[model samples]
Target: MNITEVRVKLTEAKKNRLQAFCSITIDNDFVVRDLKIIEGYKGAFVAMPSRKLADKCPKCNSKNHLRSRFCNDCGAKLNDKRALGESGDESKGKFKLYADTAHPINSKCRDEIEQKVLAAYKEESEKAKQPGYKPPAMEVPDLDFDEDNTNS
Candidate 1:
């Protein structure tokens, strides 16, 4: 059977009975009663029928996993498989890389992400190599900003 819609109400902090009272409308309009919300070691998750994700592999049209890349049933690569720059070659397929830069966050997202990743990597690498190294004391620099330099 297939579930059409799922509505869950948040309990204060029931722990086990987490997503208390979920209303799931199943196939033929008959709702399945009281599906439990389970809390795992990692996090909370609600498991439903596989049909909720996909019935067949989109690429090969084989009924393997509802959500999977290559079909385990037929071993065919699914439809949405992508190769690097495969779309631009007319001999292959049309590929489009769409970017929406109007949003403020998109403008600096790549730079900000790269800076954070590099900082984390540097810190971890330094710690990993400093098993017997002595730590050097660092001095704080004066950070006063000059405001009069722009008055040309």
Candidate 2:
């Protein structure tokens, strides 16, 4: 009823999130079927058989494979030392989120970018509407006047 371990292939890939299938082995030595892979925040995560957080390292903040402890490069411990208290369930371990920079899918960045783009688009749309369109909405404006004009 949990994921014991996971294995993955390191591929020289391009931008966006890493998407792939994973095999989950239960405590009884029985394996779960292939799970669908969508763009994951980090790399791949196998959440069955036992409990594991894939590709999340707490030390140097570099994400790595689930089975890997200590950064593959910096040697910072992948699992946080504090996670030992989590009822022996590694999945419940504290995993500082590390977004994959080398490559990312459109999912994460899409909303942020879309929001900005939508805001810009909305601004432009409003600007375009200013030429002719009018809506029944209250407008709050701060006013300033020249002293010379007031002197009259």
Where does candidate 1 clash, by residue pair? Answer: 59-78, 59-79, 87-95
Scored against the true structure, residue 70 in model 1 reaches a CA lDDT of 72
Question: Tens digits of per-residue lDDT for model 1 on 1-152?
Answer: 34455444333344442333233554548654333233445544432211122346655566643334577777777544332243534376333222222212343643443233334334533654567744333221232212211111
Which tens-of-lDDT digit does each residue in 1-152 have in candidate 2? 33354332221232423222233344649654333222344532322112233454555666565546568768876554443444655577444322222221455643433233334334433554476754323221222111111100
Determine which window of 10 residues in candidate 2 has minimal summed lDDT. Answer: 143-152
Q: Which runs of model 1 end up more than 4 angstroms from their true locations?
A: 1-70, 76-105, 132-152
Model 2 residue 17 CA deviation (Å) reads: 4.1
User: What C-alpha lDDT, on a 0 to 100 scale, does residue 123 get in candidate 2?
Assistant: 49
Question: Lowest lDDT 10-mer window, candidate 1?
Answer: 143-152
Error of 1 at 30 (Å): 38
